[model samples]
Target: MVDAAITPPSDVDTLAAGGEHCSAHEATGHHGYAGDAQALQNRLRRIEGQVRGIQRLIDEDTYCIDVLTQVSAVKSALDRVAMLLLEDHLSHCVVGAAEAAATSGDATEVNEKVREAAVAIERLVKS
Candidate 1:
């Protein structure tokens, strides 16, 4: 398990300053929809198949290193999916919330979301 208490930078401008948004979708209309959702699903399906293959390997008494290698691959695949989702959240939801908070003079909501994102990223990194 990963630690979930890390606080993110409180300054919204600093938080929004530098990162490049790398999604393929156009920025205007595709706010909430993740463009890579289908690809992420496909990757997860492949990972599931890989897991089944690991089970078969175990049933066949396959070597330990081989099983470990496949497990690592599955972990990497899951990490990729997580990263995609995180990017989507940062670009869309987090940014929008921060904008709303700034306009409404309610920075607490933005800070909370930033903390949440920080914790999520920390977990992903630890995993």
Candidate 2:
């Protein structure tokens, strides 16, 4: 279904207006989440544990509602992680684009950055 198709990209790199790499930070192997990388990793690990627990619940023939409840919890957890990532992207990547545009006198990069963020946000809302 639609929800099943909604998955986060492994890498959020995209080309700019002129076919140039737009994500300067990602180009250099530095992500917006670099500072909170460890914390994010820890959260993802915990989510993985939760997912395994859900599998165990199903294996044990747990009530359907109980399984669904756990599933909702996991979804909520993922949403939190996504939000953190979005915040990092806006603060670092989008702002960097704006700064670069200030000197280059071309808003192409900034516009593309904003469009990317909007698309990401729309996907999140749909999910």
**lDDT: which candidate is best?**
2
RMSD, every candidate, angstroms: 9.6, 9.1
Write down the RMSD of candidate 2 (Cα, Å): 9.1
The 10 consecutive residues of candidate 2 with the worst lDDT sum are 1-10
Listed in order, each prediction's TM-score against the native is 0.70, 0.79
C-alpha lDDT (0 to 100) for residue 21 of candidate 1: 35
- Clashing residue pairs in candidate 2, if any? none
Candidate 1 deviant stretches above 4 angstroms: 1-33
**lDDT digits (tens) for residues 64-99 of candidate 2:** 999999999999999999999889878888777777
TM-score of 2: 0.79
How far does residue 126 in candidate 2 sit from its true spot (Å)? 1.4
Task: Quote the lDDT for 81 in model 1.
Answer: 81
